[model samples]
Target: MCTAPGSRAFLEVGGRHYRRCEHCHCTFVRPDQRPSAEAELAEYRRHHNDAQDPGYRRHLAQLATPLLQRLPPAQSGLDYGCGPGPALAGMLREAGHAVALYDPFFQPDAGALAQRYDFITCTEVAEHFHHPADEFLRLNRLLRPGGWLGLMTRFQTDDARFAQWHYRRDPTHVVFYREATLRWLAEHHGWACEIPAPNVALMYKPVL
Candidate 1:
């Protein structure tokens, strides 16, 4: 099995090998089994992404649309993993919420984490996290009470299609979350979660 330091090895369902962290229970595709960082970066660069891409504009609106409905008129947010261009951030700003952009590869602002937000978004990004359990908790901690977390990623739909699901073909996609898995996560982390669409979810912090 492919095991990284501090990450435990788990079962391989189909051709994918898994590593389960004892502390996190995140069944991840082990590092040695994954594509090289350079290869992954090259693949990411292949995305026809630009701030001016109109299709990209409407795509970002999917997250902004739900987030706008949930948040107050002028709430602040952070678009975590905003990719090479902060389209989601721009969309949120247009919706009237101030948004800060942070991407590990692009913006890389450490200071952004210091500021809490009314909501946080991780569009098409969570499955790429190296430490999802920790990161998911961090996303939780970053939100103020009654705040929301909007995530856009394809849900693990069916075991029958596990081999053929187009989303799984992405080399950078390491973790796959089922609806029940997200539910368990929501309950585990003390948030109210819902998969409003097949590809999106909204998690609201518990109001005390």
Candidate 2:
């Protein structure tokens, strides 16, 4: 999100309030409506996303497969916000890449954030941001110039189906981005952006 001033009331679904950013077209839940950290952690713990599960691996492959194709050999990467099971990190590691894991709840390593990487994978992580602007700035700083940032999140498209959208139903999912929102982010940060696969975005930081 651009974090520009004005935003209008967007929707009220299941007693939660959402607002639409005028600058970036992002839909985000009102701050007061967001779940507490403890509640969010509890909700995340309920997920059974195993790294060894074939189906789970396949699900992650949507972002990994495309990202792998674009990466050079032996690149060092960070799997930012990797949930309890970091399946994507393992997949990237298997492909001859060095990947570090970092999750606030599961693997909180401050040292990992201190190092810069060649690429960063943020799978299904953006929507959970409480302050996307700050989080993205951190992501950009953690990447070396010309580094890649791969993201995978269910995009918000149909306003008509928003109420019935399964992605929005998740309590932890507080923000939603459209293709336009992603483009705005790329433009704001001076990165080249591409949609290599559905629900996936590949952003390349410019080399200074």
Can you tell me which runs of candidate 2 are displaced by over 4 Å? none
Model 1: how far is 84 from its true place, Å? 0.6
RMSD of 2: 0.7
lDDT minimum window of 10 residues, candidate 2: 42-51
TM-score to true structure, per model: 0.85, 0.98
TM-score of 2: 0.98
Candidate 2, 112: how far from true, in Å? 0.4
Residue range 25-82, candidate 2, lDDT tens digits: 9999998988999999999989859889999899899999999998999999999999
Whole-model lDDT per candidate: 0.78, 0.94
Superposed Cα RMSD, model 1:
4.0
Highest TM-score against the true fold, candidate: 2
Estimate the TM-score for candidate 1.
0.85
Candidate 1's residue-wise lDDT over 1-208, tens digit each?
A: 1122586555666667766554434456875677676876787889748877898888877777877877888998999988897788887887788998888777789999989989999998988876677888788888889899999988775656665778777888888776666777788778998776677889999779
